[model samples]
Target: MAPFPYLAWVAASTVLVPFASRSETAKLARADVPRSRAREKLGFATGQRDATQPLVWFHAASVGESLSVLALITRIGAALPDTQFLITSGTATSADLIARRMPPRCQHQFAPLDAPGPLRRFLKHWCPDAAIFVESELWPQMLRRTHASGARMALVNARLSTDSVKRWQQMPATARYMLDVFDLILTQNDAMAETIVSLGAPPARVARGINLKSMADPLPVDHAALAEAQTALRNRPVWIASSTHQGEEQSVLKAHQRLLRRWPDLCLILAPRHPARGQEVADLITEAGMSHSRRSAGDAPAGQVFLADTLGELGTWYALSDIVFLGGSLRPIGGHNPFEVAHSGATVLSGTHVTNFAETFSGMEELGAARFVSDAADLAEKVEALFSDTQGREMACAAALEFAQQQTDKLDEIAARLITTLELSA
Candidate 1:
């Protein structure tokens, strides 16, 4: 019933224009979009789009967002028998992660390209009864097409950045269009709730919901690998520079250099968060002239920076370290999940850009379970100081781990809300 902003988004989906010139044979040889399209094609359910069984769709943007929804999916699958799930995401990495974790009744699909044609094909075929988008995935076509199909929509774990709010406020026409799509918006914190209201979503439609990460169980690690890392780290002090961004790696290198001076055998484990960027980080380490080893490349040389360059091994890296610096915060990505660092017994240090994870970080800090650094230099200083005194490091981690353990209950509570809210509609 409201004016929509579907034209610009519709025009932008010319993503397939280049494919028009290439031969199908050539496309297949290059593993091109058509080849990727085949993968997308198989996930479609044409004739049965509106079959008797209820279809609930969950969409997330990437690996982090997809993983966050896992706990909620597991609960939904268990409680609702005969209910099928159609999960969609925009990125390849998100789809891959979901592939590994798909439940019995759930299916993973490439979200229909945001263009009008493909999105129409997608909604016309899938016709999901309820759409659940995680953490602010406000695609106009997906929301409008599905809603127009008479399906209900809700944004679980919704978030809106302050800058994004101000930006959207300037485009009230567009903001109002997308805001109306999310009938219920469960935000992660008060700051996020305020941002949502500013973005034209009414106060009544939004509420602060518990963060999924605080409710996340750490990814399990292989015992053998865990033991090997533990043995290599035996009696030697170690700390993690986790999910570190591009510029932050050089800072960690200098910090490792600084801390190594005090605790001579100190080994710094650098997890760049993006394993694909291992080479870039490796180059930074080399430019800084610190010898390093890639986790993907057999064992890291002793005294060399351990490039924990593999996905799914972050837990192992966190577990083996005594101190943890969850990255993304040092230079304003607002830090990675501190709750994860807290789950493992490690002294957690993050940067001040924690507006995103304010509640989780706040609880950890209140419990004396975590600390913050105002700058990279301060992060370096804190990492060095924590490693210098074993007693202080242990105290910090003990408090953090205990606090993290207390958060397991939040998952069930939030999952319950998702159930009640989604099942309430037509």
Candidate 2:
């Protein structure tokens, strides 16, 4: 195999590691260690080796991708009682979430940096029997070195955006070299399967599967917290704008303003996509003349908006609201997961730009499980209508829940393929 470009990548990454180790994101990822103690922070050493048992390693990009792999891991692990699973992710948030959510016989670790030296230490120690990469987190050196170690590799839930395809087309050999490393390539849809093959993945190796996120159970909720929030907002009409981006918050606040005119005691729950931006979102609520309380500050909703500025608690917010508008769709940030809302048995709503989840949203729209809004004005209208019409809210919630339920058979299909590939008879 012509792996020269990957060799070049390893060499270049060696020089970049120093800078990467010091970045704010990296600091968080590496557990807030100082740059002077870089080696300890970056997960260069894999602490222990267990070579006797078959080990399957799965790498996911971030929190979303990491959570998506849970059902697949659970199914496979149950079938292959002798096998163990290791999940590695780059972000601290993903690691924290995985710690709580990973199934029995599954372990979580911070992924080693893709630089050759750390990659070598990581691969040599883990000595995984198989490697599964999720979504689009294909690091060249990581791929080349792991494949060279004789591990069977597969890329599952693969997606190549239009921009990614264009870039891969410019460098065909490099693309093929990376794609060829995978024994199997499972795309999120038929179109993505076609796109990957066109970008040089062998046609025989590529097949389409449902987006794994569709199978994820509703994000876990703290029942006590849910009960507390329920008690706090007793008999109040509540709506949520979840995972809201910067520009979209204004739209949400504006929609809340409109909704308040009709339902004067209307409670708006605003959760930003990033917890770090909680203060900013709080500031926006202030500027919009809305009274609010911040979740991170141990305050309950004293006014119009309840700022859910905490991480990994979306499940609580989803449970508390019947009318849910998923954020990131209002602007061009594509969208966040709509399945999570549906799985929570809430009526899902979104704005026009939902290309990130286009197929899923289209199917929901067809089922009358979700509503699409054109802008802030449209969002307000939809929210107001859902709140006023009790029968409409109940019907929409039931449809959304049914739509989520119907996708599980697709998850069973994916589990069957994984079982076959892993030689786990079930």
Candidate 3:
């Protein structure tokens, strides 16, 4: 018999499925996402699965989570040539990006809504031999149905916060019921492994693993575009404030202003976290009285500040500078990934609030590959010091590069573990 809490959730979700489907379809349409893709959320699986071959399904919640597993999938595919892959994510953005970077023998799908009908139809079509859920994607119905189908299951790179652990403690039976679906639970660190075991995951099945995001392929770079932007900059000293958030840009702009005092020709590339806010960020730049050019407007990096308000071009910007200030840390938003920056041969300067990547940042700081800044003044001061000290900057960059390179072997170990644990060898 199902636990009372699980049964209650099932009843409520079944009743709400229709309304939820309609609401999601309407929202996706409003966002200009294709109707075909939106219908996927309602359990309309597209494309035919190859039944003769083993299919491994991977589910991730959004962009970062979705991208983090590509390299792993590729490695597994190389080892098991007959294994096909199905990757599902819940956002249009993730779908679009995955489509561009999908590994061979892999198909991308929008994950079905976590209700009976959608999961039923989705499972019937795909019939994946094994399923892996990335990070914190814990859909109860999805797990229950997938497990009942007899597919081996694993939860990779699992992590949870203090609040989530407490919440799960309150519903011990429900937590155990859902988590028991996984044959293995590989956590991001020892702490998370402890947390999951405490939350009722079988201690024998839980183990520590590296953060998958840290091992994802470096962001794709466009060399032609990089060349064009470099020509436009005319050899000016360059720095980037990439992935800045809403309240964080004011500080970045002020820091840029301070930077200009020492190096008048220094170029600042301001890439916001959301490119949809291009015009809004442009307004901020204009109001700040800095000369700026907009990337979406087809403007080159000619102005003192270049508003890099587009998608998937971060690698190009990173290629142009060795100094990078990754945002989201300045105001407690939990810092963005510094691994990508480090992989691009840049030394990282970030704010102190990097809880999301606390382990990664701490390791980098200890190795002298990254630094933490308090605010605009501190950010400016650090940037100036790096700019003046060529040897120091190069040493930091080398350390960061080494840190990134060290993860390659770890990824191989992780891939081997997943293949063996999931019995995915073809």
Candidate 4:
């Protein structure tokens, strides 16, 4: 609103975008985009569109954010049967996931680079009637351009971490300018709503919304792969340390080594957060004198460790194991979503530093759905007990499943509010 102060940043980014696009093209063979997609990300399908139809655009930062919006998108699509939807995300992985799951009348594209030139091209081509941004993807150029074009905009499931709030607080003018662009702001929690209002979002337009990430469908599974992994393991006690970061994998492997003493036939499925680091994790397994197989190399569980390093098959591994220790928590990485693992029917385990989903984990703990471990030794102890205690594991699994299912009512409430905000029922 106050003459968005990002012109200089946009000007510089516009000049450098071409070189950045080339660098990104080189990472096309890689799973996640390197430094997010640049100019090349503006490409969208030339699908036929009725000129009379209203088009709503949804932009999400990456795979998790993209998937979180699917249920909301589906509900909105069902209500506005004549409207078309364009879903844009910043990563190739999100694009791939959206491609497989996007409902009818919806399409996926890599989000435009948040530079003036690319943003203008993207706005001109799509000329979206309304925009909904998921999570914290606050690209100044994109938001300003969309607002200037007179499109209705909303920020849904808005979450601003303490770190992000501190960063925004340092640039009050810029933060206010960005916050004022949204016609509506639905935050992930009341605290987030308060933060948004404090940062200059109109208080009348901001309110607490349930975390849509919790409403995401369980990650999709390849049934054949799941069955194969299940048969290969032959009913042996299996557990997964999913979405592990660099240093976190070492801890997981060490825990597996310790657990092996008590359960010789135990299977540890290690899934790194970044699949590109598959080789690095495999080397760690080798150095520890453990036989391992790499999933990216098309290897199965012919050894003690099954390296689930391939992209987009977490559902299979979640299905293959009853006990799952979510990894990013072990290090200070803020942890990955354990609810998703729970949705896939696994009892969840996490490390102590789960700041990312502290509230969610706290609720789960109260419900007896998840366990916390302080270190590798604690992790090994808890994992072994879960494997041995069938009753305890089953009860946790049931509680987690119940918690995931309860998220739908929240989705329904958000969908109703979104319809009102977008004036879709008009």
Candidate 3 lDDT over residue span 36-91, tens digit each = 88888978987779889999999999898999999889888888999999999988
TM-scores for all candidates: the values are: 0.84, 0.93, 0.98, 0.91
| Clashing pairs in model 2, backbone N/Cα/C closer than 3 A | none
lDDT scores of the candidates, listed in order: 0.74, 0.83, 0.91, 0.82
Which ten residues in a row are the worst by lDDT in model 4?
Answer: 31-40
- Residue runs of model 1 more than 4 Å from their true location after superposition: 1-4, 7-52, 101-104, 162-167, 170-174, 375-377, 424-426
* Shift of residue 343 alpha carbon in model 2, Å: 0.8
Total clashing residue pairs per candidate? 0, 0, 0, 0
Question: For model 4, how does the per-residue alpha-carbon lDDT over 162-243 read when each residue is reduced to its tens digit?
Answer: 8999988888889989988887899878888998999888899998887777677778888998888878889887889888
Model 2: residue 72 alpha-carbon error in angstroms? 2.0
lDDT of 1: 0.74
Name the best candidate (by TM-score): 3
Please report how far candidate 4 places residue 271 from its true position, in Å: 0.9
State the lDDT of candidate 2 residue by residue for 32-62, as single tens digits.
6334334533555434546667888899988
Tell how far residue 57 is off in model 3, in angstroms.
0.7
lDDT of 3 at 239: 96
Query: Distance from true position, residue 115, model 3, in Å?
Result: 0.9
CA lDDT, candidate 4, residue 37: 40
lDDT of 3 at 114: 92
For lDDT, candidate 2 versus 4, the one ahead is: 2
